[model samples]
Target: MLKLYDNEKIVLIIHKHWFVMARTIATFAALVFIPPVILTFLPLATEQFDIRIVEPATNFFLSLYIMVLFIFLFLLWMDYYLDMWIITTSRIIDAEQHGLFNREISEIPLQHVQDVTIEIKGFIETFLKFGRIRIQTAGEREFTINFVPHLYEAKEVIIKYAHEAQKTQLPVTSN
Candidate 1:
């Protein structure tokens, strides 16, 4: 949910590649089985060592481990869901979610955008049509959005809006 200017329209909204979240969920699912496996072998291991461990204690510790794991997954989901790049008719908004408490937002008027480059690094990225978009601006700071899907289409849309913004708006001048 983003607020827009009266005249400004949203040109595009980009999220990280689906595979990114998919990978996270997959890893979480795999880890959820660990407690079960450990529990299954706990009796045997304890018998072999002639060690007496309370069942209630073991269950309690495993439950705690699972709770912590769930918290980690929630944090990751927040990061993934909150992080995005918004391309509006007037500007580009980069919203970065560092963790649960911190976020940084950067805005560059399209008129000041100097270049937009797309980088697809490895086989997985290329095969999945997801990569990074580097936006170079006339100002000192650069903006990079990672794991963007439909790489070429996104680049084209950004370039198009940038060109349109440039044509309609005058460049800033220094005194």
Candidate 2:
């Protein structure tokens, strides 16, 4: 959970679509089955080797490999699942997970948002309705959220909130 300023309400919470994680899931699935399949064939290929020693050694190494693969899958899922974009009434927060330890969080006030660009590249992205959303702020910094689902809606929401924030900041004129 994230801390919010007074009167600020979360308008949207965005995460990368499930399709974005498909490749990682597929790789992990393959890792779980592929190594064992290869190991099963190893005994046939190396029939000349002594079964007494090789069996124990191979089992030990296989267990170690599976353990390492599980750790890798866990880290990969954390990287994908933890990264998020939070849009609030007052600002947009970008929370990125670089690894298990390193995380970066940045915010841009709604008033500072100059432009929102949505790009849906490739056939898969277009078909799946997920793409990249780039937010160009009034400052030098830009924030890009990739593989975001419902990008058009996100852009519209940002624009709507930005306009509202800008209007609230305007000076009142005296008659």
Candidate 3:
């Protein structure tokens, strides 16, 4: 469960573009079929070698290959599913998962946000409406989210709440 500050509400939970996940699946699917396709030429191999040993060895190796591929596919799915950004009324929470054990989370308060920039490049990115959003903060540091779908809408939400958060900043104290 996500812990929130008092009176804070979540505005958005953003994931990588659906196309990214789709492409991952497509690539893995193609890889998964490679062993079977190669096995279709099994008779040629059997003619050169003993059928019993070669067939079982091929089955064993192919099974291992497929098992390894599925594990990799699961890892990709975990990376896709776990890497996310949470936009709240008070802050933007960037949580990126790298592999199984490594994760990094950063928070940028909307009040400190200096700018939000959007970049959409290439025909695919432009047509698919997926791109990158870079957040510039008052501290001069930047945080970037890539393969972000609906980037324009995300920018608007961040800008809108950033303006609101800026309005609520503590007033300057007189010396």
Candidate 4:
């Protein structure tokens, strides 16, 4: 399993479905792209193309294409691998990859969360079991961070955790 976030008291792990979606998308993309790649080589393998056009540079271009293709695949995997949404006993975190070289991690305390909303739109989303969750905070920000895919379930978990955090908090009074 992927160890996303852990602390002394609690750990928030990514749902297994998240990794399943990532792997499924990656496999589907590979299936779609591989055929064209094979077709590109098919003519050469069968000697259908004339030798004049099949210069040594053809191999170079093919290698370059393959390189680019793998690079894209690697990036896709890395994006999914790095993307993480976590809620611990104390806080909520959103970690995302800006690119191959850049990453951003944002976090807010569970005590800051005031409300949570789950939105399920479209027939397909309802059927496929994926939606979005928006969390509202007591802070200056008017909107809560949004989480997609397992919105309803995620909201439930987050709210549960936040409320648990609240139970332990001392009431505050403004002076």
Candidate 5:
């Protein structure tokens, strides 16, 4: 849950699809099983090397490797899970987690939004119904939300909000 401004209500919280996390998940799964596979071949290596020293060293290194892998995967998951685009009734908030220590959060008022572009490129992205949404603001600042699911719907929502905000900001003239 993220903190919101006074009177601001969240319209949508968009995150990258599960498909985007698949590669990292698959790689982590593969690495988790690799140690055992390599251990199976340890006996062959023991014929040339001393078992007493090799066994303890191998065990220590493998344990350290697994610990490192777990930390790496956890960080990767955090990066994916923490990064999000929050669209509220009044504005859009972009929160990006570069690493455990580095994070950036920016917000753009709905009235500042000038254009919303949705790009569904490549066969996989089109087939999966996930793509990139770029919101161009009045000051030429572009906020890009990548690998977002239901991109068109998100774009439509943003456009609707922007129009609403623009209408409210317009001055009423007498006939």
Candidate 6:
């Protein structure tokens, strides 16, 4: 029987770009709704409307508009937050967004991983699920994969791979 190197319990990706969920919400608020709200109240913008003639009806419509905007913003955030990629010792895969397009998938072998680093910065980042993972290999120079949650744990996973590459001749946890 072919033995797997890291079993699901021993090694796996716990989460994805989880921070993007919050950021996606904030982005929708800032990008979609805020602009329209500002335009609605602006003197030059709203001046085209006859507020005196359409007061009560306008108020109802305006409230509805705000409600719709909030819903759209929430949905937009949910989509972004949900987009994620994960890997375990058993397999590698990608979760991605393509406009309104939903999840996309991709994968590679653990043997491809060369170096890994976990970077945590800023006060909010330290408190939140925000940080980076850099993976280096002989095949590609590109590194600095961003917005990975629980960066330290991801680094540990990579370190585990390094141990396997060396046939676990040396302790991986040591500096």
lDDT of each: 0.86, 0.88, 0.90, 0.65, 0.88, 0.59
Query: Which 10 consecutive positions of candidate 4 have the poorest summed lDDT?
Result: 1-10
Question: What TM-score quantifies how close candidate 3 is to the native fold?
Answer: 0.89
TM-score, every prediction: 0.84, 0.87, 0.89, 0.68, 0.86, 0.60
Ranking by lDDT: 3, 5, 2, 1, 4, 6
Clashes of 5: 0
- Pairs of colliding residues, candidate 6: 21-81
What is the clash count for each candidate, in the order shown? 0, 0, 0, 1, 0, 1
Better of 3 and 4 by lDDT: 3
- Highest-lDDT candidate: 3
lDDT of 6 by residue, 24-117 (tens): 6666556555545654666565677787755666667768777887887767665665555455553344455555755565444455666777
Q: What are the per-residue Cα lDDT tens digits for candidate 1 across 1-175?
A: 4677667888899988889889999999999999899988888877755344557778889889989989999999999989989998878888989997799897888888888999999999989989999999988568888999998999999899889888988553323
Model 5: per-residue Cα lDDT over 1-175, one tens digit each? 4666666679999999888789898988898998999899988868888889999999999999999998998889899999999998778889999997899998888988999999999999989999999889999999899999988889999999889978887432223
Query: Which ten contiguous residues of candidate 2 have the minimum total lDDT?
Result: 166-175
Candidate 2, residues 7-110, lDDT tens digits: the string is 77899999889996798989888888977798879989879989898888988988999899889988888999999999988888899999978999988889
Candidate 5's C-alpha runs over 4 A off are 48-60, 170-175
lDDT of 2 at 107: 84
Q: Tell me the deviation in Å of residue 94 in model 5.
A: 0.4
lDDT of 3: 0.90
Model 3 C-alpha lDDT per residue in residues 1-175, reported as the tens digit of each score: 4788776889999999999999989999889889878899887767979888998999999999989988999999999999999999888999999998899998888999999999999999999999999999999999999999989899999999999989998432223
Considering only N, C-alpha and C atoms within 3 Å, which residue pairs clash in candidate 3?
none
Give candidate 5's TM-score.
0.86
